[model samples]
Target chain A: MSDLVSRHVGPIVLDGGIGGGAMESQIRFTGTAVPLRIEIDFPHRMNESVVQDIDTAIDSTDYTDRLARQTIAAGVHRTGTCAAKPYASWTAARGERPADPTEFAGALTLRRMIIFPDGGRNNPERVAMIYSLPDTSDEHPIEVRFLQPSGPELCPVNVRPRV
Target chain B: MSDYDDLGGLVARMKKAAIDCYMAEDGFNPHWNDNQKYAKWGWAYHHYARPDANGEGGGSPLTATTTLEAQGSVAPRFDEIRSTIDTILTGWDTLPSGALCRAPQSSANAATALLGGAASVATVNDSDEIVRATETAMASLNDLAGSFVGPVYDKYCAQLLTVTQNLGTVYTILEAQYAAQQAMWPAAREDVVAICTSAAAAWEGRAAEIAAGARQDSFTVVAAVAGAVATVATAGVGTAATVGAVGAFASTTVSTLSSLDASGGHVSGDTYAEILASLVGALGALNETIAAQELELNRWLDETLNAMSTQLADYNLDAFTLADFSAGDGSSSINRTDTDMITTAMGRVEGALSEALRAAGAPPVSNPTPRPHAIGVGLAGTHLAASGVYDYANQCLQSTAAEYTRGRGLFDAAVADYFNTDAESQLKVTTLLSQEALIAEMGGRG
Candidate 1:
């Protein structure tokens, strides 16, 4: 079984996440406007059974619907998938290969994505993402996490001062 | 021969009468050249209707035989001859006054000398003499004419041909009134002196008409000659032919003036002075016209020659030495230094040649298009390429030759103008000096 871990992808705002999780933060917008690219990496070498199951789960309509809803909820909209690598020896086993299949060292599927902090999904203010595998073997299986906004801060002292 | 045979024959007989009357000195010979001695007398016989020749004709009847019938037979003939001469010379009676002759001659001589001196010193010749001479002559006439007081003074005013007829009428009225007054006061010496003064003034005033008439005649001759020059230039006559024409015209003027001098009826002092003035004015006018034309021709020549010199300097052919081909290594590539030298030299040659074309009034040669230096090939190949490159210089030379051919006509015209004008000026001055000498001799005799 792969160990799943949450990572901070961009900037951290303590109370500025969707659903306000303490450790979760939204990606900071920087530079020129562009589509964000979200990449998901799968294990390079796994058991035949595990690989079959993961492929089946990714192909399921219900699972795709769930992933899309989660991204929308996080204030990010998925635009399109990035182009696959050229047909070469290294990229031959990436994506789906059912007959006489071979698995890549680590396969990354890139998704074109965007973030709109001001609510209207039609216009996105920030769009960018970068993903890398952890150097340590124990840091395998990166997981995508959701952020929530904390509503407001309250202060106990309410005495009015003279102008 | 019948007296009415021909006008020429009649004129010859009249001329003989004039010579017999005025110029028949002890050993006077009647050659074509000697005819000048009787020119004034002939002029008087032809031009003046008055038979007395202004007291110059020795004795009336002018016949060798003094028989009454003989004198009577010749008197009518002599009168007829005088009338004919008058009709030819002035178409009226009465000669212009002695002062008229003196003023124009003196002024014109002074002006001619001034002009000749100015022309000799002038770097760029032009005509300033005509205006100066005209002013001087007119002023002199005015001064002489102003001193008269009576009817004779009115005659002087009348002779200023430019004066209105109405002025003459007014003067006539004044003269009549003066005469009536003199009759009433018979012993008025002041009135007699005034009349004498007026008569002298009238005589002096005629100088203005003489000067004006002479000036007009001179201008007409100059205009005619200039027209002829322009016609000859247009016709593309060779320089020699044009020069010949100018010489011929000048000779004709000299001959005409010599004859006028020979017709010896001029009254010695003032009349001779007027004739001298008229000749001087004519000569001054001719000199000014020719000098102006010569200056213009010289300007063209100077401009073209200067341009040629500048262009030759620009070419600086001395700097165009061929590069040292002897040191070439047995390699296929050309030396960069040699190529550069040839290229620079060729450029200069092309530029100089273009300037030469322009000086000749030819179309400018188009600049050769620049080509990138060819990679060093061995000496033989490099030489071949250079030869090709130099083709542009050769083309420039050809173009220059064509242009020079086209420019030849202008060059010839300038040459013709220079020589012809120079000749005309010399002729005018020479003729004028001769006439002045003659007038001086006549004045001395008087």
Candidate 2:
């Protein structure tokens, strides 16, 4: 079990797709290490079926983790669920502005998460998450952990891997 | 009475013979000195044979008051002149066995030397010096040939003329070859430099671009959002609602901005690296092309030198044969000996020249094929992978990295090869030019 470092890591947004809206979030860490990977547990208030669909959409197992690690090690930037078209679609349908407070918490629930390597800013690396954020005002407190070793250990971690 | 008359007639004929000898020896005009020709010939004979005599008469010795006595006196002097003339004629007839032979022989030798010198200069130097030298030598030979006049010296004159003329032809050929070489070397050099310089500039430019792009910091969400959006309106929502909405909206915009920022740059570090790799590959191909061209040039030069050597040898043999025939001795065997000696000497010279040409590795007469222009572009194909759409971006990075690595390795190898080749080429060109200068100097001496 990885140690969780709880903090207010936010300003996370997902935009682009059929819907013109965006998803906003304030994320919490369940771990503190490089590539922070985590499984999101949606609150009971959200629709069960919608939650299930989000779960299926953002789901990652040992296979996906290994695949992501392999991809990154090959000198590629691997994002867990950010590459998924369904996730992009979900964010866009939520509308340009944040939902009302009651709806905001449900919409911001996280299903899966992956972050890019730190770009030397001391801030968290770029994050790619599969979550149900229906509105721009969604504030999901997501749980994340250090995906041990973060990326593929075999891959170079330098700014320019090929260089 | 009859014996006295016969003696008088003999004396008269002797006077005429003496006059003819004097005119021939002194180069007097027969038409201008017709009346005095015999008188002058007799006077010279009288003066030379008997220093005590005062034989200064302008009239014919036959018309003198002491005509019979004068005729008697002048007969012995004429006899002596005839004897000397006979001796000279004998020397001319047996010329091949005496000093007279040296004239034609020396001229032949001079001709051979001039030909040899011209050939040497022609082989290494492409200049007008050899041509001028050759022309001077030919002129001298022609003058020597023209000096021999009269029927007695006809054969010798003909032989000298033939040999000299043949040598002139050889020099003419040499002059032409030198001129051609002078024009060819510089043209080829210019072409080579132009192509190589272009290639070097292209690689340098590509490497610099890659280096510049790699140094750029990745754009973060904060920068992207600030640049992307200006304001958020909150007209309908309550004060607290609007504030919460604004805060959430800010976070969402920032994250979206980050995604956009990552994808929007002209080329990623991986792609730049790939381009560098492609540049390396192009260099490798260029190096190979240069090597091949150099080799071809060397071979061509060797072949050309060999051909010229053979031609010079043939000319030398022909010149020697002509000299031998001109000896007029009908001694074919002796002529054969002389021909054999010249042939042997020429063979040695040709062999030496061939060896030297091989060592020098002469430049090509023609320009080598230009290296492929699209080498860099062709090597740097699209970096995207051949798989799933989701994997496209990552695949591009991975593929490009791999390509870059391969290209860089090739480029390094090419650079090494280029340096080595460049050094050798520089040395070769320097040596060849030096040799040319030396040959030119020698030609000037000739």
Candidate 3:
């Protein structure tokens, strides 16, 4: 398994998106010179499903291993900041007394959600998500921003399966 | 009198042309003289494919030992023909100015005394016979002189004039080709070097990005797989958590792949190689023209010698008639004007030559008829093919192609493979995640 070795040098801030179809989140890290931008978009149903799944995972339910369960819960976060806000609002939020992106000096992973379009009834397209987990920081929260997609359709144009 | 001077003038022109052919600027020098341009081209050719960092395998400059080999091929033959003409001219000057020999003075007093004393008809008739035979022999000597100094010399001189003009044409073509190359080479090298250097630097700058991107992409997939496996092994106990974790990881990998897309890591320094290829092609065209002209010249020289021999054979001087002269040289054909066949093949590359010249921005060649008298020499109607030109042309092409390949194909393939791998990993991860979702739904979970 490959692991990212770095610390976030800036606060997570929402960025504007392409015609309200996808929302972007950007954070800087110590290992990379450029800010990593995460674009989020999903159909309303998948959004509810993912949020409920996170809720279920975070539920105070019976579990043999509580640490692993809590670790998974801390890794996910939902934002009330509407992505459809004016570009100026997003920038203002990022500029308000710059929180040291390095405030959290622990291993962090940036996750993005990718949804493939359905081919046919026989070959249904499915959703898959990937994580950027740092090997040294399994305890640190894996940050995920579930942004509100304001577009008519959440799927990016022609998301091919073998792309 | 004008014809006599014309014949001498033709010989002088032939000599001048031959000497010019022997000299460097007038065409016969096969080795290219612009070392500065060559040095520039060599630098670009060798360094264009080199990576920005030191110790990368780059092209080495190609040698021109093959170019040097063309040195004596053309010039020495001109020298040999010039020397032969010089010998013939010198020998012409030593020919007898008067009758081949003085006939015994007609003794008038002895004739009168002998005729009055005995009136011997036999003695008188014998004297007459001696006079007739001497007259006939003298006339034969005069005819031999006329033939040597007139038709034989004139025909050969006329042909030599054409040959010299043809040589001049060759010289003009070679000069223009050389000039065009000189004019185009430096600019071409500069462009090539700048392109390669900039490309190499851009690629170098992206090294860190590509590495970070690759790690992020691979790490995400690996983490997702491990989480999925753990969830399955635990009998769906941590299945919801596993789905969340794997989904996050897959998204990270996808993001990294998107960022890394078109990151300039796969750029190649092929600009220089391409320029070298173009220059080599120009050189090949130039060399082919040279070979064609060379072949045409050889044919002209042969025809000139044959014409001279045919004209000279009609006035054979027997050994008995002129004690010091013999018809043997005139009776047998002389050696070919040029024994060396410079080119094994020939063709008209006029269109290609002009196009190459235009491409190089070379001034048009000054020859009125490039390949003059090609029809007269029996080459006008023939379809010809030629491949070898100064051996150096082939060497440049071969080496340039080999060197240019060093910078390009592999990098492109690598970029393609990177994308393909990324795509495959995405599909596999999505397939696994999708299966896990199906399993969760099948287990009567929300």
Candidate 4:
């Protein structure tokens, strides 16, 4: 993130955990009258709770790798799941077909979630919930992106143009 | 409201005129170049003007010329000419009583040596009445050399007085306008200060809520600014107090802002919103007051210059009109007589003196010889001095007009400078206070 974005947007925080407690991250930006704070919850999932599939799409990298690999414009790039990490990895049983359907590290699933505080536009207690689709193919992945829904972002890019 | 009022220009002009007159007394003095010749000629003319018995010389030959004409002693034309010369000389020498005159020391010395000395120095006119009167006029032209300013001042007195009054009026108008602005400033400033103080207090009331992380919103950013301002007010002694203030304000403002529905809008009903409206009103009024003051000052300057320009034009016309000194126009002198009259008188005076010398068996002379025959010399010398007076008068008038015109130009330049300076000042004040500028600075209405 650029200095300007860091000043207005929170740093991305991700936690690696089992299916027990839900980890949360916040992305807040200035809005008219009051600031709108966004809280995202990532629920942990146990390996046994995950459903078995013959063709499960998965990623083998850690959360940092996921973040780094994503195309993000340095300054005001508000895209990507700010908090995403490996939830569970899966491997197929001994080969009974073309291959065992597994590599050194097997299929992995990353979960993203959000909970809004209120429904009012100017309410300070407003919370939001966001969830990206879990079924992503090997060629494509989904990320939860934060948006400044209050209005246009009052960042340096928007404000410094005034004479 | 005012402009440069330097008295240096006026003082310098007066000083220049005084110096020119002083120099003229020396440079154009009839006897400055030829003292002895003038002394001799003045002696004869004075004697002729008043040839009395007892040899004190009180009787005038000009008075007797009419009698001489009736008796066929002189021609009628000569009598008329002599009368004309007498009239012109009477006007030329008409100075105020007790006026200083040139001392006739040179003529007196010459006369004393000629009449009251050795046989070689004695002349045939030793007891003649003509010789005695010659001594009188020569002692009186010292006053003539000193009379230039007096007549010139008298001639232009009315115009100069008008110019002076107009200058005074210009200053008076400036003072009045300045006083009016001064009177308006204190009240206007008080009103603005009062509004600012109230707005500050209202902002302070919300500072605790903002610092306590109550209504965390975009306004929290503004509250954080207020906290920082407070820290600055305490000169860094309140740093700890400012830390939480910045934290809560920044966190709450950003967090609250991120939840706003992209499709919706909200009108703030917060204390800060009211403060913005109040401040905008106060600043707009202040801007209007400043603009009004500028307009008032410029109006007064324009009016004063208009009146001054009109008067200056009239003064210039008078100065130019009176500059012509010719026989064809009667403005040849302040007394208003044709210049031809003075020349005519000069001719007659010379003619009479020449005939008198001839009748006395004195041969006509080329250069004046101190002999009684050289009475014709004084007229040219006296006329030369009079011409200097006219030239000096014309110069003074033209200079007065030029100076007045220069003063107007300076007044105009001063007004222009005042407008430029005031305009820049007003722009800064108005721009800083304008609602549009404030809105832009505060990240727009949102």
Best by lDDT: 2
RMSD of each: 54.7, 53.1, 41.9, 46.6
User: DockQ for all models, in order?
Assistant: 0.00, 0.00, 0.01, 0.00
Q: What is the lDDT of residue B168 in candidate 4?
A: 26
How much DockQ does model 4 earn?
Answer: 0.00
Clashes of 1: 43
Which of 1 and 2 is the better model by TM-score? 2
- Better model by TM-score: candidate 2 vs candidate 3: 2
In order, the Cα lDDT scores of the candidates are: 0.25, 0.27, 0.25, 0.26
- What TM-score describes the B chain of model 3? 0.18
Q: Which tens-of-lDDT digit does each residue in B1-446 have in candidate 1?
A: 42222324333433344433322111111211233222111211111122232312222322122222232333354455345444432201111111222222222222222222223221213233322333332333333211111111121112111111111121122122122222211111222222222222322233222222221111232223233223222221222223223223224322332222211111212332232233233223322332222232233223323432343211122111122222122122223343333233323333433443232221112211111222111112112222222232223233333322222222223223333554433333334334323322111100
**Docking quality (DockQ) of candidate 3:** 0.01
Deviating ranges (above 4 Å) for candidate 2: A1-26, A29-163, B1-273, B314-446
Q: Tell me the spans in candidate 3 whose CA falls farther than 4 Å from its real position.
A: A1-163, B1-145, B180-187, B197-446
Compute the lDDT of residue A38 as modeled in candidate 4: 26
Minimal lDDT window, size 10, model 1 chain A: A147-156
Model 2: per-residue lDDT, tens digit, B68-130?
233344445445544543432221111111122223223322332332333332232322322
